[model samples]
Target: MKGFGLKVTETGAKSYIYQYRIGGRGSPTRRYTIGQHGSPWTPTTARTEAERLARLVGQGFDVVAQRQENERKSVSLAMPAYVEAFITNYLTTQWKDEADGAATLRKHVVPVLKSKSFPSLTRSDITAVIDKIPAGQMATRRKVFAILRKMIRWGIGRGDMPQQDNPLVGFEAPPAPASRDRTLTDGELVLAWNAADDLGYPFGPMVRLLIALGQRREETSAMEWNELDAASGVWTIPAAKSKNGKAHIVPLNDVALAVIDGLAGCADSAKSANSANSARRWPKRGLLFSTTGKTPASGYSKAKARLDKLMVDAEAKRAKETGDSAELIDAWRLHDLRRTMATGLQRLGVRFEVTEAVLNHVGGSKAGVAGVYQRHDWKEEKRDALQAWGRFLEQLAAGEPEQSNVVHLAARG
Candidate 1:
């Protein structure tokens, strides 16, 4: 009671309360709730600890301030602070807002390098991570590296980490080997088209669009009703969602238009059947394809799983009928369908620039300059190009005018 202060109460409460004075200007008194009557801190022990704290405060120590200061000083490193800021601010706000970016970072970069000091990461460390991934995954490595570089740059810009050159700078992986030529041969094209037709649930239209337009898989899957201009025969992909961050205008051929029309019919039929429950059955927003009709399909994971099973079944059937080994038929991928379109267009004498523009690829030397200057979509040229490609595919499907031996000879020569 002499060295420390105390409060007494007489209203049937059996315990005394401890009191202390805070040392700033007003010197307001604070109380610590030790215990009621028969628990942990006895009066003597509470008094001693309070005396110690009081002594420290009397000497301008300010124990609470000191503890906070110690905590502030304890957070001295860049990596832990970065991780906190990245999880709270960057991942939650910026990266997560973008479609699939959070998953990409979490799956690819965070698992490997989240704990690493931004300043200490070296090109060799990055290359080691890259090397661990199996060969032929150059695209995946490139994307992971890009995400890491961006995160590091963000940290540096925000002053959370020291400025360092991005470790991914000049980091190059070996070219992925050209796997089996995705280009479908004339016979294979016919076979795949027929197969798609026989198994139609939209596979036929999907295949036709993939072959006719040569758009990326996700781009095709993300296509919305609002993006299509049936009258103008143009499908415009907005810049924000595009991989290149530029608006891409695809000139739709008659074949592509027909496919869209067919899909519209299917959608109409589904809606008609569900008319009584239309609000529940159809999505509020427009998506070309949706699961139960609410939001756009996020990924092709389910569809891809089903397709993989189908491919396995197709291979088994091929093996049984043709006596071909399993290895021979398991060689194709979905992306091969796009390659087939490109190769088929090339084989039909379409100009390289026209094909590249149709595919929305960065143009070649001459066309690159033209692409900058022209400012136009080159809609007419693209239309002609796509129409010609579609006609070629139709011919292949019909087996009309057999594929030329001369073309094969020229290819060999």
Candidate 2:
């Protein structure tokens, strides 16, 4: 009776009430309307309501404040709603530079969790969705999980969600994947280089350019004629196109220049003759490697598969010629060529700073205060290193053994 009461009006309407002192004795005790005392709110039901409020008071929550907060976020501030708000307002705007990060959330996280109300997103539901993703693509799963966790934290901090307990608190993420550092040996490089040439046109030229320039695959793939300075032998990767968000000046060696020349000729021949043969490699005049100028170069997976077979055939042919069993090279990715070039420079004793400069790495020794102070672009060093490597590649392609010990300055003098 102390915590509960009944009210009756002249019209015979009756209701239940629960009252509580805010600041103890002599302070104003507030009465909360529990329910109308009728079918649903009999004395027994009204008593239960009083008991619930009493427990809440014991737990130190101002039930009135919580109700108001819940009411505020009722429909428009639901879980999915807050998630979208986070993406549009926070992820997209404040973190504008990380477009890929926002895209991943919008693409992967939004669709799966959009309909799920924020309060309804339990650990089990999160785990269930994660479990369905195949183990072969754990890396993607891990990213999605991480993004979702961040979203939950953001909601909690902003008071969009109940300001307690992270839904993903104890759930473990899939192991972070190992970074790929695969590199092709000199033999593999020569074999693959020849194999790419035999493959012909687009994929061939793209592969050669990747190895030739040691640039990223997409950068090589998205090349435009305008980016090339034929006379100076510089293939400029514009800031927008480069991964590091810096314009990269790749000093092209004779072989790289020759490959570019061959590709341009191939594209010209295809266009003049009105053939679709080069259409896949040269979508338009400006594009150097794309199948369609509107998009970056594609068919990488399929093209790589074809290149593998060609390499194996090259191995077989060599075996037949030498009267010895020739073993095909080990498996590798297009990125391995980039690594191989970096490794080759180091093995040849080229300065690591120059190597980093050629790769356009924004971090490591090339970055931070050290990078700021070391304003030297190492342009001349990079050119020398690339030219030396190009000569080695030419020798290998022509069946002449590599002269790795040759000193550039000594030879010049």
Candidate 3:
């Protein structure tokens, strides 16, 4: 009776309680309610389990510690849950303020890792996922590894799992190959401008504005009528619309001003021909460039397709007359125009800071230091830079400068 003892307690109409006492002098008896006497675990199962527990305890074994150890091993085996908890708690909530960082992880990281358990995930598994991504996306892969490391660290902090000691810690994908810097040559600019003019579509003026002002396609596409100062010949791009999150002042050269004037004329013409209600319905959010059906243009895919066709036609015509391959003079992209403007400025002997400021490149000295200290808007310098660029464009258009060269001023000049 030393290792085994039991006591019966209350009977609530039909219920009964049982108790057990461990062996020894001062040890107190412990009560364990075995269900209603008639039910399963009846007297038989309870007695069997209790006796087993007593024997294990007598051997210096801790049942509670054993159960906990089993549980720890089970949890260690559940890899999928750890990955899910890490992504939900850390990636979504903890790093929520990193702009689109959370979205990128959810889209790219979660799907692949959701079914994979932590212990099973190897360095090769990570590398395999990264390799499937196009080589051009090496930067994106590097960023993804950082997010994964953060997620694993978060799991360790919660005490639900051990540290992953991230296998991807020092892994680096090869640098993405550099793409061709396809800034337009002077002759190409002339062909594109002429083709745009001949097409005589809404994109014509927009293309002119892009070339003259060197604004990003999205910035120009989202431009509002209110942002334009026709009298002062300036177009103000708001900070939110700008890539650097800073407002920019672009001096509207004569060509850019003319394009805006033409747009205004077209809007007035639409108003005159329609009923008052119809005229009011005309998208007057003051968008300078809009879709053909009067809504603001949201994307450039359709427009680019049309532009590409026009360039193809022009190239074919040139090829037939001169016996040159059409591929030699094909369509250029809208982005290339910005590069053309930058290269054009560089060729005009414009200062590097001035050129970078015009392009809104953030890494330049003027972007960081002078952007703060030289608080004076450098309005004249900007005007001079744009005017020089415009004149160079005109010379190119006129076919005066057959070859493009960076113009440098001599000390005597």
Please name the candidate that would achieve the greatest lDDT relative to the true structure. 2
Candidate 1 weakest lDDT stretch, 10 residues = 404-413
Q: Model 1 scores what on Cα lDDT?
A: 0.61
Off by over 4 Å in 1: 1-97, 113-132, 164-181, 187-208, 266-285, 289-309, 315-327, 330-334, 365-368, 374-376, 395-413
lDDT of 1 at 284: 23
Q: Mind giving the per-residue lDDT tens digits that candidate 3 earns over 11-74?
A: 5443334343455557665554434556565556666666777677678665555767966755
By TM-score, the candidates rank as 1, 2, 3
The local distance difference test score of each candidate is 0.61, 0.73, 0.63
Query: Which candidate, 1 or 2, has the higher lDDT?
Result: 2
- Over 44-124, each residue of candidate 2 has an lDDT whose tens digit, in order, gives 988988999988977777766677776776655664566667777777544423345565666666566666667667887
What is the per-residue lDDT of model 1 for residues 1-413, given as tens digits with 9 covering 90 to 100?
Answer: 64354445777554545555665547876555444554555677776677777677668665666667755644533445555556566665555234355555565554666566656777876776666666666766766666667777776787655665656567674465555665656655555554554445544456557766788766776678788765466789877556666788888765566566566753322221112543212222376755545534454444445555555566568778999775343346567877778777788788777777777777573355666776656668877878777667656655566534212110111
> How do all models score by TM-score?
0.62, 0.59, 0.53
Superposed Cα deviation of residue 386, candidate 1 (Å): 1.9
Pairs clashing within candidate 2: none
User: If both were scored by TM-score, which would come out higher, candidate 1 or candidate 3?
Assistant: 1
Task: Report how far off residue 213 is in candidate 2 (Å).
Answer: 1.5
Higher-scoring candidate on lDDT, 2 or 3: 2
Task: List per-candidate RMSD values in Å.
Answer: 10.3, 11.1, 12.8
